[model samples]
Target: MTDTFKHRGLRQKLVETVKAKGIQSEPVLKALGKIPRHLFMDSGFLDHAYQDKAFPIAADQTISQPYTVAFQTELLEIKKGDKVLEIGTGSGYQTAVLCELGARVYSIERQQELFKKTSKFLPKLGYRAKKLIFGDGYKGLPEEAPFDSIIVTAGAPFVPKALLKQLKIGGRIVIPVGDDVQTMTLIIRKGQKEFEKHDYGEFRFVPLLEDKN
Candidate 1:
């Protein structure tokens, strides 16, 4: 709960590190700078919180690397007040970043432990998502369809069609698609049945699980 001046200085260095890695989105960098990433982790890992790397969290999931979060968020190109859906609400770090950017976020978490913990924790920090569901990320949130953008925080073997269909026309999804290693993929909906796909380079992430809750 304590974010001291030292923590803020470390976070600024982290923003610089991520920026050096080619994350140029001002909004993304600003949001990263604002969020207290160390507060999202277990106290034991506090010393490593500001490094530009992912670290283990509860349920064996990793809070995504700062650079990866920035890269994916920047690709989504979120506008203020845009409705965004986030899959795999791990430590709620990414959700906080999305909130910091002013997106109306609806996030799903398959891990009940994380879901319950984060459901309570995020609001305490004033990063309130529109909805946080303890459900399968693979299914997406169809009840709240037509999101302006969707971001999958874990690696998927392939893009989930349900997610693709959930986007508003011209909306985009930033997902990492693959197995052990993932290729960061961006798919933009062009029309009722048309999508434009682009693949960025590879990165590793926890697998996006399905139906285990």
Candidate 2:
């Protein structure tokens, strides 16, 4: 429960590192710098927490690398107060980043342990989502449909139709789609039945499991 000057300094370095890697969104970088990433992991990994790397957390899931998080977030083009659906809560690091940008996040996690852990832990760190649900992310949250943006933090074999259907027209979705390796993908909803897809390159991520509650 400690965020010190040392941590902040290390985080600044991490932000610089991500900036060198082409994550130019100032808001995203500010969020990266503000969140105490070390606090999201077990204390045992504190030394590696701000190293721009992804580390495993509870339930066999890995927190995304800082660059990846920034990349996805930058793609969403989030605006303040936008309703955003996050498809994997993992360590809640990305959730905090979204909150930092003033987005109203509705996050879902397939792993029950992670959902319980992150849902409770985020508030202690001064971050909170609009809703945190333990459910299959593939299904999205139908009742809360039409998000201004949606982000999938894990590797999906394919884009789920439900997620696309849940976006507000002109909204964007940033995701990594594939199995062993994923291509960072962005889909912008142009109209009622039109979407524009773009790929930003490759990344590796844990599989996004489906149909599990």
Candidate 3:
């Protein structure tokens, strides 16, 4: 619960590190700077909190690397008050960034342990999403579909068709599609049945598990 001046300084440095890597979105960078990432992890890992890398968290999930979070969030081009769907609420770090940007975030986490922990933890830090459900990320959140944007935090072997159908016309999804390694993919909805796709190089992430709920 303590975010000291030292921690703030470290976060600013981390922000600059992410910026140096080509993350130019001011709003996204500002949100990253504001959130206390160290507080999201256990105190034992406090020393590594502000570094530009992911670290293990509960339930074997890693809080995403800061650069990866920034890259995906920047690609989404989040606008204030946009309805954003986040798949994989691991550590609630990405969800906090979305909240800081004023997006109405609906996040789904399949791991019950992480879900319960995060559901209770996020509000304590004042990063409250619109909803946090313990369910299969593969299914997306159809009941609350037509999101302005969707972000999948884990690697998927292929883009789930259900997620593609959940976007509003002109909306976009930023997902990493692959197996052991992933190709960051961005798909933008053009019309009722049209989508524009782009890939942004390679990265690794925990696999997005399906149907284990």
Candidate 4:
């Protein structure tokens, strides 16, 4: 692969865009800068891969818009070597970002084609995960219980109870919650019985569903 990101214009734009929008986390910006988004998208989309808008990938799914990805990633407040569980892997773009932030990622994708295909792309992007599961993400990764952070890519009716259970104390979960016109929410598990929820703002996303394929 070429060093396409070195001295790239998009990286500069990402820095400016996130900064203008109040994305305060430096590591999140660094990951956005370093990741070559063009590689993850269809060749036809190479021209717009680095833009802030979401674009279609395989299986009728779109890569998360760069701003949304940055917003959610920053909400996690991650440090080095955190264990993150990602529900709704989609194009694996957000999964790659979490991995870049020094998280041991375990990503679950509901679409069989997306899971099968992105399973290979992860390595190509230079990120390793505990596993990429082809399953209903609503259930989460039970075998790998207790994630330091959990991020859900799709919009759900509410934070899944199982997911809240899996978050270790002080762990943060960023999710999109609603049936229509979802709001991006951050859920912090403070203890075995207490959790705090914060809503960032309205967002439109494909609804989170329960199915393996």
Candidate 5:
């Protein structure tokens, strides 16, 4: 694909833009540069792709802003080959970033239309995940328990405990918790009975809807 102003801007302005907002991870900046944010948003909003704003995608969900994506990814403290679980695959933009960072992304989406569409879209764009499930992400993926990391794209009333169970020891999970407005949070499973929590601050996100077939 031919590189455009938007694409180049994403790589160029990422550190400056995210640093201004308190995102402090070189790895995240590099990943953001690699992932094409323009492909995730609507054509009308493509010009605004690297401007650090969320843009609407299919299923009435918005692809998160660059800083938010970088902030969440940074909190995970990812390493190469980490087994990652992503709860909501809205637009698969975040998923692409995770995969680009060398995480084995296992993403689940409740929206049938969104999941089905992204299944094709992700591979076509060259950001393939370890797995993609169309069922409710609230329950987490039991069969694939013990993931090295987990990320929830949508906001929930509280951090889902079931997801905690699936997290491997010494792993992290980034989730947005609250109602109306949410706190982007990171949870780390230190051990069998120990864990750590960090709040990345507030964000506006669509509710994590429970979907069943």
Candidate 6:
């Protein structure tokens, strides 16, 4: 939980790198710079933590590149106090970012090991989600229906209906859909049964598992 001047400097550089790559959301950039990405990674790979690339974390998942996190977050168009649902809580980095942006985050992680580790680690880093659940992301948090925004961090073959249904009308969902090279898709709930879809670009991510096996 030690964020030294060096860490802060690296984060500032990381922010500039992400900004140069076209992430214009000031809030998102600020959150990115504020979070200590190295704390979310293994000490052995600490040097690579702020390099704007995804690195392996526990449960065979990657922490996600800073740019991707920023891109998905910006697509959500988060507002202060917005209720956000995060489908994957891998390193809790994105959770920290959303929390930094003043969103109430409800995060789910299917891998018990990563879930347990992150659940304990996040609070130590002073980033707390509104609720951290251990369950299948595909089913989503139906009891906490109608989120202001939902973000799926993994690549799914198709959009989960449960996630779409759990969003508030006019809420937005940012998910990567595809088995191989996933397309970053943004879906806005226009009405009870109407939604608008926008595709950003391609990205490669680990598969989104189901059933909490």
**What TM-score would you give candidate 2 relative to the actual structure?**
0.98
Candidate 5: residue 50 Cα off by (Å): 1.4
In candidate 4, which residue pairs get closer than 3 Å at backbone N, Cα or C atoms, i.e. clash? none
Ranking by lDDT: 1, 3, 6, 2, 4, 5
Greater-lDDT candidate between 2 and 3? 3
lDDT of each: 0.96, 0.95, 0.96, 0.87, 0.86, 0.95
Candidate 3 achieves a global lDDT of 0.96
Candidate 5 residue 200 Cα shift, in angstroms, is 2.9
Instruction: Give the least accurate 10-residue stretch of model 2, judged by summed lDDT.
Output: 204-213
Could you give candidate 6's per-residue lDDT for residues 89-208 as a string of tens digits? 999999999999999999999999999999999999888899999999999999998899999999999999999999999999999999889999999999999999999999999999
Question: Which one wins on lDDT?
Answer: 1
Which portions of model 3 miss their true places by more than 4 Å?
none
For residues 1-213, could you state the per-residue lDDT of candidate 5 as single tens digits? 356765776667866878877877777887787777777767888678788888888878888888888888988888999999998898998999899889998999988888898999899888889999888888999898889999998889998889999999988899999999999888889989799998877998889988655
Candidate 6 global TM-score: 0.98
Please, what are the lDDT tens digits per residue for candidate 3 over residues 121-179?
A: 99999988999999898899999988999999999999999999999999999999999
Model 4: runs farther than 4 Å from truth?
Answer: 1-7
Pairs that collide in candidate 1 are none
lDDT of 4 by residue, 1-213 (tens): 454544377767867887788888989998998888777789899778777889999888889888999999999988888989999989888988988899899998989889988999889868888789988888998889889999999999988899999999999999999998899999888888999988888998988879734
Give all candidate RMSDs, comma-separated: 0.6, 0.7, 0.7, 1.4, 1.6, 0.7
Error of 5 at 56 (Å): 1.2
Quality of model 6 by C-alpha lDDT: 0.95
Model 3: ten consecutive residues of lowest lDDT: 204-213
Model 5 misplaced stretches (Cα beyond 4 Å): none
Residue lDDT tens for model 2, 123-195: 9988979999989999999999889999999999999999999999999999999989999999999999999
TM per candidate: 0.99, 0.98, 0.99, 0.95, 0.93, 0.98
Candidate 2: the clashing residue pairs are none
